[model samples]
Target: MASTWRTRKADQKTNLAKRRSPNIAEVSIPTHFRCPISLELMKDPVTVSTGITYDRQSIETWLDMGNTTCPVTNQDLEVEDLIPNHSIRRMIQDWCVANHSYGIERIPTPKIPVTPAQASEILSGIAAASRRGETTKCRELAVKVKAFAKESERNRRCFMSHGAGRALAASFSAFAAGPLENSKTGVLEDILSALVFMHPLDEETAWHIGSPESLDSIVLILKCGDLAGRLGAVLVVKELVSANGEWVEVMANTKGLIEALVKLIKEPIFPQATKASLVATYYMVNSDVERMASRFVDLGLVPVLLEILVDSEKSMCEKALAVLSGLLSCEEGREKAYEHALTMPVLVKKMFRVSDMATEFVVSALWKLCKNYNEEEAEEGGRRGESLVEALQVGAFQKLLLLLQVGCSGSAKEKATDLLKLLNGYRGRAECIDTMDFKGLKRPF
Candidate 1:
């Protein structure tokens, strides 16, 4: 441990130097001086079988995590053995001594990591506790595991190696299997929080959590839990879907699951939750199934997305536009979009307001609605003509002309040109016209 005064003196001097120079790259730290795991000065350097050196503590933690491959080399480790790199440690110590005036403190030797036998014993204990339905001990173990995992990348692997992730998953299963009493909610929360750190979860672990009961629990959290719980559920769902989307599709297709996700977007939650929901929804909908599109419409997804498009930040607007475009491609989706008052105007208005991505998506949405228009109803000036008429009334034609004249992407210009030609027939124009002002238009044909 560093002495208080010494640590304070070092920090104060460092701060003073930063205040003086701001860009302190003039006195650069050597690359070899830093540990790959912590990116700090390495006190106890050690070499793995892959011939790459890392801090002893970091490599040990990594091995303890159950990772059989070297983090730096990505090669399979011959064994979990790590040799002390005494020469590199001495070099770091000497450099620190030489730079003493610059507030550099020599790094102290790191402590030994827990042995394999000891790690196995801890995991066995947790597993046994889980089997006995000891929720309190399970929660405590999860908290400790998450704490360790958060300390460094190496620690995460180490914690996972000890079957902590499986134990946490089991704890969740146990908690979810029982009644969701207020007292047990905290334990569930702790377990979920721990699971968040073990991202890109393996297929087996994902299979365990992607069960119907577990998915229902996650959806319930999205509905009733706090921000952290909702965010955790969203991330966990994303991971599960990514690991095995077909498995998640079965859960995502359920009305309750779809409704909960749509409701999440309508809620005044932060954009992270909303963004995650969008991605999960996109992944679930990325199939040739018609029900996916209809499900979004049945749950009133268009209007919710319209609201999101209006006030959402730029990135959110892009995602909302993409999902909206996908939904509009289906016949039912087009009908649902036409039902909304702001859908046409918002789609047209966003054509030039956001980025190129937004522009392309908005135009695609318009093209879909136009391509799917009922010819008989359009000729009769019925409900099918409402969207086309609204597009004209809202100056969408003017925007498309402007995009083509001012130079847009090939795809955008292509779709815009096709839409312009299609609209000309509806307006009784004899030939294509480059018109902007929507007011003074007679049957120029």
Candidate 2:
């Protein structure tokens, strides 16, 4: 069936070419002057092992999409090699120039494709630099690797298949552990940025590079490195947590990882770094490790998150709110959040201030506090009542009522309704409740 289809296509192309040439007096380009695959003028013409010439992109698309037979010949391709049809390409260029009055533009020469061998040689050089602690050489080679990989899909696959990804990762791990005095921290950061750009690399290679020692090195970069380095390290850590399955827990337990992340959150040199730190922290806290979640609270992350919320743009606000929501899932997290002076007001102020997502996170967090803190716990000397009283005193009940009146999301409205009920049940005719005025309730959304 496939052979017959290819034959039909070839015949159709031939017929089209014949039809196009008959009107040449009207500036009609001969169909044979175009690639059969694209039905357009060819650029970067190359012939396959099947003796059929095609535009390089069109043929590459054919093979990349899993077709092994030649489009024009209907013959099984003997090899995957593409030999540049320079003679034919030059002819196309000359014809275009001759037809310049007809609005034809000559095709410029295409860049020489990087061979797998060239990419492999660069990888080998990077590995050697790793062994010799040659930071400058490693940075230069790392740049070359990134350049080649960015040149073409074929170059990227070549690097992946020929072990360039693994080699580069190994080199990163080595330099990450080397003496900081020997190499400028910027060099190490460049190597890491190279890895971040070549993501979804081999899973085994990812694991080999994301070892405990390497993770510690990355965390160190997060703590004291330059802004770009900090941003790159966060991305690298995000990738490791995603690719390395159970290795996430390993990273969560890495000695200084959490503390470094918290510090980054508190004093992010760049906005992207703060966002990435929030993501990295989200991953670790989402690991569902009890001790890990508590440690975030212990490190005073809640208040830092609170501070971040004050000036955060919508996206960052959402993430900070989410982390707060997650932290509130446990007793320690709740205690920390309720204890913070700005927690209630910030949550209230951001209720309708940011996006729907931010509102949802805020509502969910407040609901967690209201629903979970019980009277029995209050009788036992818990701060549940105190927190609730604080919520009520700060017009939390009024905000809940306003949320429902001014129209929030279905989920937010439901949570608001429940919170109003919870607060009303706890304190009848609460002092703050008398101040509620439905006429004044208004929101941008």
Task: Show where candidate 2 strays beyond 4 Å.
Answer: 1-62, 69-113, 150-154, 176-180, 184-187, 201-203, 310-314, 340-363, 376-445
Candidate 2 lDDT score at position 93: 89
Candidate 2 structure, TM-score to reference: 0.67
Clashing pairs in 1: 64-158, 65-157, 65-158, 65-161
Error of 1 at 224 (Å): 1.6
Candidate 1 per-residue lDDT, tens place, 208-263, comes to 67766677787788788878788878878867765675765676554477777788
Candidate 1 has an lDDT of 0.74
Candidate that would win on lDDT: 2
Worst 10 residues of 2 by lDDT: 436-445
Q: Any runs in candidate 1 off by more than 4 Å, and if so which? A: 1-123, 160-165, 252-255, 286-290, 330-332, 352-360, 374-376, 392-417, 426-445
Give lDDT tens digits, candidate 2, residues 1-445.
9999999999999998776554435776667568889987898888888777888888888887888889888887633478999898888989989886665778998877778778778888989988998888999988877777777777777777778768877887787664555355767777777676677767766765687667777877888887767887888776776665576688877888888888878877778778777877777776756577888888888878887887778989988998888777777888877677677767877887888788888898999887887878766757776777767866787777877877877888888888888788766534563322323433222
